[model samples]
Target chain A: MTERAIPWPMMALAVVGFAYMLLPIFVVVLAGLTAGEFLTFPPEGLSLRWVAAFLQSEKYLSAFFFSFRLALMTMVVATILGTAAALFLARSNVVGKAALRAFFLSPVVLPGVVVGFALFAFFIYSGMGLSRTIWGLWIGHILYSTPYVIGTVGAALAAYDDSLEEAARSLGASPWRAFRKVTLPNISQGIQAGSIFAFIVSFGQFEVSLFLSAPNAEPLPIAMYNSLRYQFDPSAAAAGIFAITLVIASVLLTNRLVNIRRLLGRQQGQ
Target chain B: MTEATAARATGARLAAPALSRARLTWLLVVPLLVFLTVFFVIPVGLLFATSLNPQTIGQVTVTSDLTLDNYLRFFSRSNYLLATGRSVALGAIVAAVTLVVAYPMAFVIAKTAHPGRNTALLILVLAAMQLDMVIRLYGMMVILGDEGLVNQMLRGIGLIGAESSVQLMYNFLGVVLGLVQFALPFMILTLVGVIRGIDPSLEEAARSLGASRRRAFFRVTLPMSLPGILSGSLLVFALSISSYIVPALMGGFRVGVLPIHIFQQVAEGARFQFGATIAVILFLLSAGAVAIYLRVGARASGGRA
Candidate 1:
C-alpha cells in the first residue's frame, strides 16, 4: 500500500479492454429485445417478436436440435477418446511418447480452416461425401474438439496420485477393477471439464462446418453467418443472444459442478 | 521438476506387474495411435501430395507433373507477397499489443484481493470464449464505422464537423482492433495460468531489498513472467495470421490476408493447387512459431529453475 494515486492509464486500458469484450454481447442482448426490423443499435424499442419468431420457425428449431444432439454426441465421443489417450500417455512408458503427444495435440495448433480443408479433401477422396449427413458433421466436430479433451484430462491425470489405484489393487482388486473403481473417480473432474469444453467447441464451430455443412444440415454459427451475410435481420442478434446465454449457462454450471476455475487454471499450456 | 514428475510417473508402472504391463500399454495406446495416423497424419501427407502434384486437386487433370509453381506464384506476385507480409506484420503487432495490455490485467487479476479478482477473471474467461464471431465483428463495425456509435458520439460532442470523413471500419485499424480484441483473452488466460504458478516470495524478496515498487516489479515479476509472455504472444500471432472471418468481415475487400486469399482461391477462384499450397504454408508457419515458442519457454524455464 504505497500511497500512490490510481494508475489511471492502466485502469483506462482495462476499461477499454473489458468494454471491447462485452460490447458485442451487449449489442446482441439489446438487439434481441428490439422492436425494429433491422439490427440497429440504441434499438428502436423493446419487443419479444424476434425471439418468438426464432422459436416458431421450424427450420431454426430443427437445426437447433440437430446442433444440440451433435454437440452432445461429440462431447461423449471426444471425452472417451481424449480420456483414454490421456490415461495412456499418463501411465505408459512408451517409446516416442513426445512425438505421440505432439501428434495427438496437433489439432490444437493447426488452424481450423486447414483442418476443415483436409477433412473436406479426405472425405471427398474416400467417397464419404455421399449425403453430407449429420454423421459427417459429428466426425469433424470430434476431430476439432478432442484435443481440448485430451489436454484437460491429461492435466488432471498428471495431478492424480497413483497410490489410490495401488491401494485398490492391493485390496484384492483386479487391474481393471482398480482402474474402474479408483482412477475414474479421481479424474472425473477432468472428464467433466473436458466434456464441457468439447461441447462448447463443437457447438461454436463454424470453419469446419463451413466446408462440411450441406444445404439441409447447418450448425447455428453457419446459419447465423449466412443469415447476416444475406440479410440485415434482427434474427441474427436474437440468435447471438441465445448462443451467449447458452455459453454463460454452460460455463457457470460446469464451474458449479467441477470447480472449473481450477481446471482452467491448470489447463494453461494444454 | 521433470525428474520428479518422471519418478512419480515410474511409480504408476510399478503398480502393475511386469507381465501384464506390456500388453496393457500396447492396448491403451493402440486406438489413439491409429486414430491419429489415419485422420491426421495421412490427411496432412495427402494434402502435401496434392499440393505437389496438381492432378489430384479435385480430380481435375490439369497436369501430371510435379512443380513448385504454386509456391513460386505466391512469392513472385507483389500483391501476394505483400499480403503475406501484412499478415505477419499485423500478427506481430497485435500480439505485442495484446501482451502489453494483458500483462497489467493479468497481474491485477493474479495479485488482487480475492472476490473481485475472481469474478473479473471468470467474466473475462467466459466472455472470451463466447464464440459469436459475426456479432462481435458487427459490434466492432458499429464502434468504428462511419455511421457507428463512436462517430455518432463524436459528432454529438462536437469534436469535429458532421462532414468529416474519418473512416475507421474496413481498414487496417479495424482489422487490427478486431484481431486484438479476439486474441487478447487467449494471451491473458495463458499468462494468468503461468503467472499464478510463480511463487510470490520472489517478488516479496525483491521488495524487501530496499527496491522501489516499480524497480522490484521490473526486476522480479516481469522476468519471472517472460515464459508466459513469450508463449502467449506466439499463440496470439499464430491465431491472427490464420483468422479468416474477422479480417474478411472487417477488412472490406481492400486488405487481403493469407486466409482471405486462400478462401477466394479455393471457393471462388477454383485454384485448388494454389489454395492447398497456401494452407500448407499457413500450417508450416504456425507450427514453426509454436516450435520457437516452446524452445524459448524451455530455455527460460531451465535458466530460472
Candidate 2:
C-alpha cells in the first residue's frame, strides 16, 4: 500500500460515482426477483416466479438457447483466428505491421450497427444466400468478436517469456513442439480468457444482431428489445438477470484463468 | 576468425532465417486478413457505394446512374441535419459528463494501493462493463422511468406533489444519462492507468514546496494526467455517438439520433440507400473522432499508441 491517505473528499466522490454506476444494476436484479406482475424496484416481495416464467416462455427460451448456440460458434472461430493473428503479429517483422494491426481491429472501432447494416446489404447484393440468415449474423458476430480475442491474447503474448521457448528449441525439440510445450502452456490461459470473452460478447451483442437477426429466430437481446418495446413485463427483467449472470460468471472465470489486471494494463484494453 | 569474415558469414546466415521468419509470419496472418477483408471491409465498402446510388429502394449495389441524391436529401432535410447535430452534441455531452463522474473514481482506484481493495474496485468497474448493455439499461428503466426509483424517492421525500412524475427516460436527457453510465467504466479504466503511472513524488514535491493539497493536484497531477483525460474523453465520444442500443432503449425511439435514424431507415423502413447515407455520415463522424484519438494517443505515448 502507498503511504498516502487518499483524501476523504475524494473517497466520498468515488463512493457516489460507484453508486451511480451500480444503481441501475441493483434495480434490475431486484426488480427481476420481485413477485409483482409488472417490474418494480425494492421488490414487493422476493420470489423466483419471473425466472421460472422466463425459463418456460417459448419465445424467450428459444431465443436464449439460440443466443447460446451463436455465442459458442462465435467463440470457437474467433479464438482460433484471433489467436493466430495475435501470434503472427508478435512474432513477425512484417512491413506496415502497425497498419495491419489497425485493420484487424478496425471492425470494432466502427459502430456495430454499421457493421451489421453493411453486412446485411452486402449479403443482399452478393447473392450469397446469407442475408437475414443465421450465417450472415454469425459472420457479423465473428467480425465483432475476433478483435476482443486479439486484444486479450495479444496482451498475453506480450507478457510471455520468449527465452523459455527458445531454450526448448535449443534443446533440439521441433519448433512446433517447443511452441506447444513451452509457449502454448504459458499463453493458453490468455486464449481461454479471450475465448470466454468472445462468448460473452457475442451472447450479449445487440446492435449487430439488430440488422442481421433472422425474422423467425430472434436472438435474446432483440427478443428482449421487442418485448420491452411492446409490453412491459418482469420476464424481460428475468432475461436481464440471466444476461447479468453470464457476465459475472465470465468475469470470475476470466479472473481465475488469468490476471485480468495485466490484460487491462496493456494498451489493448479489450 | 577475423571480425570482418565473421560479420559477413553471420549476415549470410541471418538474412536467410530473417526472410523466412517474415514470410512465415505473414502467412500466419493471411487467414484472418482474408476473413476480415471478405466479411468486413468489402461489406462496408459496398454500403458506401450504395449510399452514392440514386434513391432506389431495394437497391443494395451501385448502379451506372450514380447520384448523390441520398446525400443531398440528408443535407436538405431539417430533421436529418438536426439528427446529425444532435448526435454530435450528445456524444460531446456524454464524454464531458463521463469525465467528471469517472475522474474521481479513477483517482480513488488508482491511489488505493491496497491489493484487495483495488481488486474489488477494479472488479466492480469491469463487471459493469461486461454486463450486457441491454440488461444494464433495463436497470436504467427501473431507475429513470416516470414511476422509477428516482421519482419514487423524490415523491417520498415530498420534493414534488404526489400527482406529478418527472419524465426522465424517453427523451434526450435519458440518452445522455445512459451514455454516461455506459461510458464511465471505459473512461475510468483508461484514466486509472495514466493516473497510476504518474509519479506520486511530483505531487509530494508540490506539497513540500508549500502548495496546498488541492493546488498540488490541480497544478501537477492533473496536468500530468491530461493525456488520459483527453484520450478517455475521445474514446467516450466515439462510443456515445456510435451507440445504438442506449439511445434506442433509453430514448425509447423518441430521440432521433443518427444511429436511431439509421436503424429506422435501413432495418425497419427498408430504405437501404437512405440508411447507408446516414451510416456513411455516422461513419465519417466516428472516423474523425478516431483519427483525432490516434493522433492524441500517439502524442500521449510519445510514439505508437
Candidate 3:
C-alpha cells in the first residue's frame, strides 16, 4: 500500500475533529469526579464524592430506579413485539412489503417530541383515563423503543440464510420447531442486541419523557434537565457518570456478542 | 451488481415457505400493526387534524368546526415567524458545520485498513452516540457554561476581563454547537460507508494518469461520496429542527424554536389547538426533508434502497 503514512495535515484534522467530539465528555466526567463543591474549571481535582452523593440522594435515586424499571419493562415488551415483526418482514410474502417496513420504522423516523405530544393529546381527548398516568408513559416508551428492536432484529434476519429453517421443516420439523431450533439460535444475537438497545434508549429518553412522564414520578432525564435548568448540581454530573456507564457496558456487551459495526450500518440516516 | 442482487432477492423470496406459513407469519405482524395504529398512527393523525381546529385551551376533543385561524395566526405573528426561520437556520447551520468537521474523521476511518483500529473507531462512535442526551449536554454545559473552561482560558489569556466573560452558551450559538456535537457521529458514520464503498481502483487510475493525490480525491473520491454528504446533511437537518432538549438546555429557555413554542403552548399552557398547529408545521418540515432523503438515497443506490 503506497498510502502507508497518512498525510500529516489530514491526520491533524482528524485529531482536531476527534477532540471536538470528545472534549465535552471529558469535561463532564472530570466535573462528575470533582472534589470541589461547584463544577469549576480544572475540576479542582478528582474524587467520587459527587457520585457517592448521587447514590445517596433520595430524589435522584428514585428517578434512577424509576428509569431502570421503565426501561426493563420497555425492554421486555419491545423485544417480543419487535422480534415477531422482524420475522414477518423477513420471511413472509406480505402485501406491500416496502410500505409495511416503512410504516414500522416511522416511529423512529418521526421526532420523539412529536410522538410524545401526539400521544399526550390523544390520551387526553380519547378519555380512556390514560392521561398523565404510568400506563400512558409505558405506552410512549414502547412506541419509541420498538423501532430500534425492529431495526436490529430485521438486520439480523436479513443476514441469516432462511434455507436452514426450510431444510429443518422439510425433514419433518414443525413450523414453530424449525424456528425454535434453527432460526432462533442464529438470530438470538440480534434479539439480545435489540433488547439492550431498547433498555438503553428508554433509559436515556428525554423528549418523550418530558411530555408523557406521570405526575410525582419523573424519569432520570427529566430530573437531570430540571436540575441543570434551575441550579448547578455536581450530583447531576454524577448522574451523567452513571448514564455513561450504562451506555459503555451495554455497548461492550453487544460488541462481544456481535459485530456492532454491521449493526451501525442500519443507522444510515438515523 | 444490481442484477445479481435483484436475482438473489427474488430467489430468496421463492425459497421461503409456500404453505399456511404465510398465514402464521402474517399473524406475527398483527400485534405491531395494531399497536402502531392505536398509539402511533391514530395519535399522530389526530394531532394533524387538531391543528386545523381554532385555538381552544384545554379542549381535549377535536371540534367539528374547522378553520384556518391557527395557521393564519402562526403565519401572521412576527414572533412565530422568527422562530420558524431561526429553527430552519439552526438546522442548516448545524448540518453544514457537522459535515465539514466529520468528513476528515470519516475519511480517516474509512481508509484506516487495519481492522482493529477501524473497529475501535466504530465502537467509539457508537458509544458516543448512545450516550444519553441529558448527560452529553451536561458535558457541554461544563465547557460552555459561565466559568467554564473556554471562558476561564479566555480570561487567563486576557482576552476579556474577569467581570466580562463572553457568553458562550445560553443563546442561539450554544444551541448550534450542541446540535453539531450531537450530529457529528451520525454524519461520520453515514459518510464512512459511502466513502469506503467507492472503488479505490478509480482513484488509483486517476493517480496513474499523471494526477496528484489531491486531484484524484477531488475528481474521483469526492464526487462519488456526494450521496453520503446529501443524505447525512438531510438527516442532520431533520434531527436539529425537531430537537427539543438541545435548545431547552443550551439556549437556557431563551432560544424560541418551533419545538419550544409547541411545548410552551401545549405542555405548559394547555393550549391544544395552537400546539397542534406548531407540531403540524414541524412534522411537515421534517417529513419534506426525509422524503427528499429517501428519494435521493434510492437514486444513488440504483433503487436498491
Candidate 4:
C-alpha cells in the first residue's frame, strides 16, 4: 500500500540484468547490418546486404518455408488435440485427474535432448522412411508444443463457470452446440494464445528437429546450425535477426490476444 | 435441507447418468492418451530398451541381448565421466548466477508501484523467452569473440592493448554466459509470480517491528519465495545441463558436456547404444531434480494432499 523507495543497488542491478538480456540480441541485429563480410560489433558500414543475401539464397529460403509449413501443421494439430484434452480434464470428474494432468505435461520436464534421441530411435525402429521424416518431426513438435496449449486452455477453463454449459444442456441445446456457442467463445483467447505459443515453439525448435530432419529437408535451425558449424559468416547473423523478429512478433501478438503475464505466471493452483 | 438428504438426492440424481457422462469424458481424452502412448511413452520405453541392448563393433546394428556394456563403458571412460561432471558443475553455476541476477529484477517488477514499467519489463522477459536458442548463442558468439564487442570496447577504452583481448569465447566462460542469459528470463518470470503472491503486509509488518529493510527482505520475503527459488533453480539447472547448441556453438567443441557428448556419440560414431545410455543418464538426472523439487514443494505446502 505504501510507496517504497527503490534501493540504488537494486536499481543498478536491474539495469545490468536487462542489459545482459538485451545486449546479445542488439549486437546480432547490429552485426547483421554490417557491410563487412564477418560478424563484428561496430559496423564498418551499415547496409542490409547480408539480410538480402540470406533471403535470396535458395537453400535458406527453402529452409524458411519448410519451417513455416511444419510449424503451421504443428500448431493446428496441437491446438485441436490439446484443447480437447483440456476440455475433458477441466470439465469432467475423471479418476486420477492429477496423474493425467502430469502425464500431459511431462514433456515440459523431459529434456529436449532426450526427447530428440528417443523420437529419433522410435522412428528408426518403426522403419519410417526418409520421406516421412517431416511427419516424424511434426509428431515430435506436437508432443512438445501440446503441453503449452493444454496449460493455457486449462487455466482459462479453471476460471470458467461450468454451470453455463449445464444451463444450455438443460435447455434444448445439445452438448456440442452448448460448447460450440458458449465454451469456445469464452476460451477463444486462451486458444489463440496457445496456438501462437505452439507455432513459435515449433518454428524455433532445434533439438528434436536436429535429429529427426532428413538430409534434404532441414529446418531453419538445423540449416543455421550446419552453416555455423561449417562456415562462420555475417549471413548467420542475418538469419538470426530473422529468427529474433519472428519471436518478437509472436510474443507481441500473444500479448495482444491474452495477458502474457497471466499465461507465463500459471502455477498449479494460482 | 439436511446434509444426508442433500447427499442422497445428489447421489440418486447422478447414479443413472454418471456412467454415460464418464464414458463421454473418457472418450474425449482417448485420442490424446492413445497419441501419447504411441509417440511419447513408447518412444521413451524404446530408448530405455536401446540403452540396455549391446552393440557389436563395426556393426550398424545392435543386438537384443541385454547387457550393461554401454553403461560400463560410459563410467569407465574418463572423458565421458569428466563431461558429466562438468555438465553438473556448469548447470549448478548457471542456475546460481541466474538466480542472483534475476531476483532483484523480479522484485522490482513484482513490487513496483509503476504499472507501465512493470508491463514493459514483463514484455521484455517474455520476448527473451521466445527468442530462439541458436540465435541467442550466435549473438553471444558475436559479443564474446576475440575481435568481438567486449574486446573492441575494452581496447577502445585503453584498458587493454590493441593487439590483446580477453579470451572470452571458444571456452567454458562463453558457454556459461550464454546459458545464464538463456535461463535468466525464465527465472525472473517465475520469481515475479512467486514474489507477487507474498502479501506486502507481511513485509510491512516486519518493518514495523523495527526490522531494517535488508533484514525484512532476508527474513520474510526471501523465506517466503523459497518455493519459487527451488522450482526456478531446478528448471534452470535441467535446461542448462541439457542444452547442446550453446555448448557446441559457443564452446567450439572445447567444452564437452553430456548433451554434446551424446550428440557426438550418435552423430559422429553412429553409436546409438552409447547415445541412449547417456540420454538415459541425463533424463534420470533431470527427472531426479524434478522429483526432489516436488517433494520439497509438497512439504512446503504442508502436505496438502
Candidate 5:
C-alpha cells in the first residue's frame, strides 16, 4: 500500500491525545512507588513499600480473590449462553430476529446505574437475603457481559462458512460431533475474545456490584472506593496501579488471542 | 400403488430433519432469552414499577397503592430537577468533547499505513477502556489534586505562588475531565470502525473532482461517518449520564448528578422508592435518546434494529 502523508497537525494531536489517555495511568504507577504516606508525584524517595503493604493487606487480597472468582463464573456462563445464542441467530431463520438481537443486546445500552438499582430493588422485593447478594452480583455481571460475547461470537459466526459444518456432516459425522470438532475450533477466536471481554468487564464492574455487595463480600472496586473515601493514602494508588497492571495484561493477552480492533469494531455486524 | 405409498412415506421422513433443525435453533437460543428475561428485563421492569409504588418514608415499607407521588416529588424539588438537568447537560457536553478529540485520532488510526503504529494505538485505547473506573478516577484525583503533579509543574515553572494551586478536583470541571477520559476510548473505537469502512478512494475521487482536502473530508468523509458519530455520542452520553463513581469521587460527593442522587436515596437515605423514581427517569432519558438514534439509523440505512 502506498503511504499517504498524514497532516502534521493530526500527528501532533494524536501524540498529545495518547499522552492524555496514558498520563494518569503512568502517574498512578509512579505514585504507587512513593515512600511517602500520601500520594505525590516525582516522589521524594522511590520504593516498593506501598505495593508491598497493599499486597500484605488481607482486605485487598480477599477482595481480589472475590472479584477473580466472580469474573470467572461470569465468563463461563456468559460465553456459553451468548455463543449459543449467536450461533442460533447467525444460522437460523428465526422469526423476530431483529427483536431477539436487540433483547439480548439491550444491556449494552442500558445504564449500569439503572441495572444496579433495578437488581437491588428486585432482590429486596423477592426477599433474597444479604447472603444472596453475591449471587445477585453474579447475575448482574453476567447480564452485562453477555452482550460482548454475543457481539464477538455473532461477528465470528457471520464470517464463518456453513459449508464446513455441512462437509463434516456429509463425512458421516453427527451434528454434535461436527460442531464440537469443526465449528467450535473455527469460532474459538471469537469465543476467546468474548471470554476476555466478559472476564475483564466482570472483574472491573462497580456500579452494579456496589448495590449488590454486602459488607463482608465487598468486591475490589468497592473496597478501593471505600479506601479512597475514608483515607487519602498512597495505598489506594498502589491498588490502582495493581488494577491497571491487570487490565494491561488482559489487553495484551486479548491482542494475542484475536484482533482486538476487529472484535470491538464488528459490533455493527458488518 | 404400494411402491407409490412407500415413496410418499420416505418423503415424510426426509422432511423431518429440516423441521427439527429449525426447532433446534430456537432451542439453542431459549436459554439466553430466558436468562435475560428473568434477570435483566424483569428486574428493570420491576424497577419502573417500584417508581410508581407508594412509599412509607422513615421506614422500610412499600405499599401496592399506585401513585405518581414519587415522580411528582422528584420534579417538584428544585434540587432533583437541577440534578437531572445537569446530568443530561453533562452527558451531552462529554459526548461532544469526546467526539471532537477522538475523531482526529480515530481518523489517523483508521487511515495510517503503518500497521505497527495502528496496533499500538489500538492497544492503548483498549487497555485504557479495560482499566477499572475506580483506579482511573483515583489516578485523575492524584494528577488533579491541589498538591498534585499539575500544580507542582506549574509552580516549578513560576506560573503560581508556593501556597496557591489550581482547584482542579472537587468540582464540575473535575467530573467532566474524568468522564471525558473514561469515554474517549469508546468514542475512538467506534469512530475508527466507521472511518475505516469509508472507502479511501472516495476521498481521492473528490480531490480529483477539484475539491480541496478539507472540502473532500467535509463532503465525503464526514457525511459518511455520521452513523458512527450518532452511535458513539449516544453510547457516551448514556454512560456518562448513568455514571456514579466519577461524579461521586471527582465531585467530592457534592455534585448531585442523577445517578449519585439515586445512589444517595438508596444507600444513604434508605429511600428505595425515591431512588427508583430517579433511576426510572434517568433510564427513560438515555433510553429515549438511544431509541431515537436507532430509528434514525434504521431509516437511513434501511436496516433492521
Candidate 6:
C-alpha cells in the first residue's frame, strides 16, 4: 500500500473554479462605482455617483421598493403554504405522499420561462387582472420560491424526533401547542433558511417578471432587463451593485443565525 | 386512595379527542393544490391550447382555427432546427465543462481541513445567489466587448497591437461562459453533497489495496458518486437547454437559441400560437431529459439499496 498525499491538482482546480464563479460578480461591483457614464472596466475612477443616481431616480427607487415588497409577500405566502405541506407530509401517514411531494416541488424543475408563460396566459384568460400588478408579481415569485421552502421544512421535519411531540402532548399540551413549542422551534432554522432562499429567488426573478411586468410594478431584475434591452448605461450597473449588496446582506444575516451549509444541505434533500 | 384512583380512572376515560386526520390533510393540501392548479397546471394547458389554435396574422380572434402548422414550421425550418441543435450542443458542452470544473472543487472541499473552507463555501453560495441573469450577462459584455476588461487588460500588457480589438462578444464563447457561470453553482453543490456522503473507509480501503491515488478516486470514489454526477449534470443540461436570458442578452442577434426564437415569436411577432409550439417543444426536451436523469439517478441509488 502506498502512502497518500494531498491532491494538489484538485485543490488548484477548485481555486480556479471559485475564482471563475466570483470574478464576474466582483467586476460588477467595481464597474458600478466607476465615475464614467458608460461602463469602463478597471474602473477609470471610483465614485458613488451611480449609487446616488440609483437612489435619486424615481424609476429605480420605486422598482427597488416594488421588488422588496414582492419578495416579502412571496416569502410570507410561500413559507405558510410550504410549512403546511411539510407538516402534512411529515406527520401524517398519508397515502400518495410521494406523488404529492413531487407535485408540490415540481416548480423546481419547471423552467422559469414556461412558468412565466403559464401564469401570463392564465392571468389573461382567467380575467384575473393581475398582470403587472404587485400581487401578480407576488404570485409569480411565490410559485418560483415555494419549492425551496417545502424542501427546507421537509428536511427539518425528517431530522426531528416524533417522541418530542408526543412528550409535549403528554404534558397536557394540545396538538397545536405541541407543534408550536416542540416542532416549530426545531424547524425554525429550516424555515429561516427557506425564507432566505425564497427572498433571493423572488428578488432576482426575471423570466416570470418579464412576462407580467408593467412599468409601475417592475421588479429590480425586470427593470434591469428592460433597461439592458433598450440601452446600456451605468444605471443598470448601479442597480446590479444594489442587488449584490442586498444579496450580501441577506447571506450575512443567514450566517448570523444558522450555518449556510446546513441551509444548503436542507435545500438539496431529496 | 380509593377516591384518587377513581379520579384517575375518570380522567383516563375522558380523553382528548383526536383531530380528524382527513380534515387536517385536506386543509393543509387544498390551498397548495389550488395555487399550483391555477398558476401551473391550467396555465400550461392554456399555453398548449393557444399554440394549437390557428390564427391569421393581424387578426384578433379568441378562437383559433386549430392546426399543426406552427409545430410543422418549427420542425421543417432549417434555421429553427439549427438553433435548437446549437442550444443542445452548447448545453451539453456546458454541462460537461461544469462537471470538470465542479468535481475537483467538490473534492477539495470534501477533503480539506482548512479554516477558510467554510467562508469560501459561504461566499460561493452567496455569489451563486447574487448573479442574476441580466447582471451576469451585462458583466460578461463589459469583459468580452471590444474595449472591455479582457481586451483592455491585454492592451495594457502590450501583448496585442493597439487599436486592434479582439472580437469575442456576441458569439458562442461569450454565451457559454455566462451559462456556465450561472449553472456551475448547482453542479458544485450537488457534487459536494455526493462527495461528502461517500464512505471515507472505501477510499482508504482502495489505497490499502495498492491502487494509485488517482486510480482509487476513479475506481472507488467516482463510481459511488455516480448518482450525484447524473443528477447534477441533468440539472445543468436541462437548465442550459431552456435558458432565455443569457442567450438573448449575450448571444446577440447572430447566436439564436430556441428560447430566444420563442421569445421573439411571442413577444416581438405576436405569433402566440407559433411561440407556444416552440415553447412546448422546448418543454418536452427539458421534460425528456429530466425523466431520463431521474430514471438513471433512481437506478444508481436504488440498485445500491
DockQ for every model, please. 0.47, 0.65, 0.65, 0.62, 0.64, 0.52
Residue A256 in model 1: lDDT: 60
Query: Each candidate's TM vs. the true structure?
Result: 0.90, 0.96, 0.95, 0.94, 0.93, 0.91
Spell out the clash pairs found in candidate 5: none
Candidate lDDT (C-alpha), each = 0.75, 0.86, 0.86, 0.82, 0.83, 0.78
lDDT of 6 by residue, A151-209 (tens): 87887777789789777877778778888898889989878877887888888888778
Model 4 bad stretches (over 4 Å): A39-41, A130-132, A268-270, B1-17, B57-63, B298-305
lDDT of 3 by residue, B182-229 (tens): 899889998988887788889889988999888888899899899999
Docking class of 1: acceptable
Worst 10 residues of 3 chain B by lDDT: B296-305
Model 6 chain A: lowest-lDDT 10 consecutive positions? A1-10
Model 2 residue B274 distance off true place after TM-score fit, in angstroms: 1.6
What's the i-RMS for candidate 1 in angstroms?
3.0
Candidate with best TM-score: 2
Model 3, residue A98: distance off in Å is 2.0
Tens-digit per-residue lDDT, A1-270, candidate 5: 542466678778877887878888887887788878765545788889988888888878788888999999999999999999999889887678876777788786777888977877777777775323678889989988998898888877877898898778667777789889999998998899888889999999988787888777788998889888866667767877777878888888878877766676666433
Interface RMSD, in order shown: 3.0, 1.8, 2.0, 2.1, 1.9, 2.4
Per-residue lDDT of model 2, residues A34-111, tens digit only: 988865544578899999998899988899898999999999999999999999988876688767887788777678
The A-chain TM-scores of all the candidates are 0.91, 0.94, 0.94, 0.93, 0.92, 0.91
lDDT of 6 by residue, B219-292 (tens): 99999888889889998999898778887777776688878887787678877777778888888888877777
**Candidate 3: share of reference interface contacts reproduced:** 0.67
How far residue B178's Cα lies from its native spot in candidate 3, in Å, is 0.5
Ranking by DockQ: 2, 3, 5, 4, 6, 1
Model 3 Cα shift for residue B6 (angstroms): 29
Q: Give the runs in model 5 whose Cα sits over 4 Å from its true position.
A: A1-3, A39-41, A130-132, A268-270, B1-14, B58-62, B296-305
